[model samples]
Target: MNLPLNRRLFMVGAAAIAVSGPAFANTTHIVEMLNRHPDNKKLRNVFSPSVLKVQPGDTITFMPTDKGHNSVSIDGMMPKGASGWKGKNSKEVSVTLDLPGIYGYKCQPHYGLGMVGVIIVEGEGMGGNLDAAKDVKQRGKAKAAFVDHWDQIKAQGLLTPPAEQ
Candidate 1:
């Protein structure tokens, strides 16, 4: 009650801002499109951190650390109605996914070579489309790559089959 008018107004404004701020800040993840795995030279045309986990409203930026590489989402690999992205080769692309689900992506040119990655968005309803994403047909080396990704995801306890859910 003893506070000056301007000081009281300032305190009220600051309290309003604090109360309206976002509850949690979204994070940005980086994925590098590489010609060779940083840890293993024998592996070719890979996405470093091939399996990424993110939160809703988070951003994933794919950087072309090596040439002839681009990131693209597979046709049936995302939550229904979620927008997919395609990056130009040799350029960087950033996408923010607000929907919670599994996203499977690969390099357009090297898809058959198994240049693929998975993004798992964690939140309520995150597993709604997991089964559909897992059932997407993969060809060439991509088949094995996706199998490995699925296994890793399961190991992490992130992927739950519909029957179990």
Candidate 2:
């Protein structure tokens, strides 16, 4: 059957919209949990790129290059409606982040030495989790180191750059 040109264009546009949706634009980022800092021995046992900033619906894969580390979210550092996650010890875990906020995470066994990481999800604004993460009452050496990491993240405009080669 033959159709008018206008009708054909409308049908094609509608089909295109149906095929391309928000999910098609989501991205996946890879992060490594390393056993040592390449340049600083004192920084041994850390997340390669200790900080990350991503859009909502993005996924992050936390892969442990070291034998004894895990990525676990800080108790209070999630958006109001966001749920937290904890990867299996020393294993690779992929998480699809649907909420927009700041997330602070740490290695369960190495929190003291500051084996920590932070993530920020862009939303309406920086979420309410930042203060909570800062006031977490951290213990051991991490108490001071965590603060330093947070300050650095803020100084760099809230994005942790990829580790230097």
Candidate 3:
């Protein structure tokens, strides 16, 4: 038996909606970090775009163009029991963040030089107030330290000095 035109159209519409729904639902943002400094040998950290704000379910792509650079979350600074990742030799790693909070992370060997960064995860009904999250103090301090020594860091050739510090 042949189906009616209306029924066939409804099925087509349903299939189209099902196929396109996931595409629109999952959106990922790519954040790239480069080891673009001579003195980066001292600290393997994210020099450019050090701070990132992303929504839940978004992905941050950490690309290290140079060797001896990795991205990892730290305990107390990130979600509980977080740890750093091993260096990726010219590879891209994608991190999908789902929690809504302030996440602090650093390179294992370079945590001393403040090779640290923050991920402000914005949640629903939060009104983009990522600073309201817990552990803001520690994350803020780390961010400030990184910013404070940015000049010296660039001078040391660990990062490409932007037009303005």
Candidate 4:
């Protein structure tokens, strides 16, 4: 059957949306950081499943397998700040990403070693062109603003040290 061009386009669009529905669910994705490194510091890596793409309202759980390892959001997508810690020995850190933008994150202590990751919140025409590491650098300045407030955070006890190594 020869369908009209508009109808065909509609069908294709609908199919694409259906196939990518799971990526937009308001759920959480857990990413762990293994505490394995020659220096006993957290390895400079995003741990398992490096690439994580989730929809708005979804949460990403960062769990440190070793002590002294933590994940900090270098992008403004997280409400807290550019840097937040999930102590090496602490439980999982759950972040509900409710905005529609690309978010970059990394482990502060290990950032110099290139340990980084990204989260792209599904929204109008923002998909299909995401570079995890690049996003972190682009948002570097905004992240710095948040990092400046670290002292206040520490006083609040929001910063938890990793477990005893």
TM-score of each: 0.84, 0.79, 0.56, 0.50
Candidate 1, lDDT over the whole model: 0.91
> What lDDT would candidate 4 get against the real structure?
0.55
**Higher TM-score: candidate 2 or 3?**
2
As for TM-score, the candidate ahead, 2 or 4, is 2
The per-model lDDT (C-alpha) reads 0.91, 0.81, 0.55, 0.55
Q: In candidate 1, what are the lDDT values of residues 8-43, reduced to their tens digit?
A: 999999988787766467788999999999999999
Residues 1-165, model 3: lDDT tens digits: 489999999999998998888645656665555554444554345545566667667777776655565666655554432233443545667777776555655665455656666665555432232223233444434556545544443354332222443
Model 2, residue 123: distance off in Å is: 1.2
> Which parts of model 2 have CA positions greater than 4 angstroms off?
1-24, 159-165
Which structure among the candidates has the greatest TM-score? 1
RMSD of each: 4.6, 5.6, 9.3, 14.0
Name the runs in model 1 displaced over 4 angstroms. Answer: 1-22, 160-165
Clashing pairs in 3: none
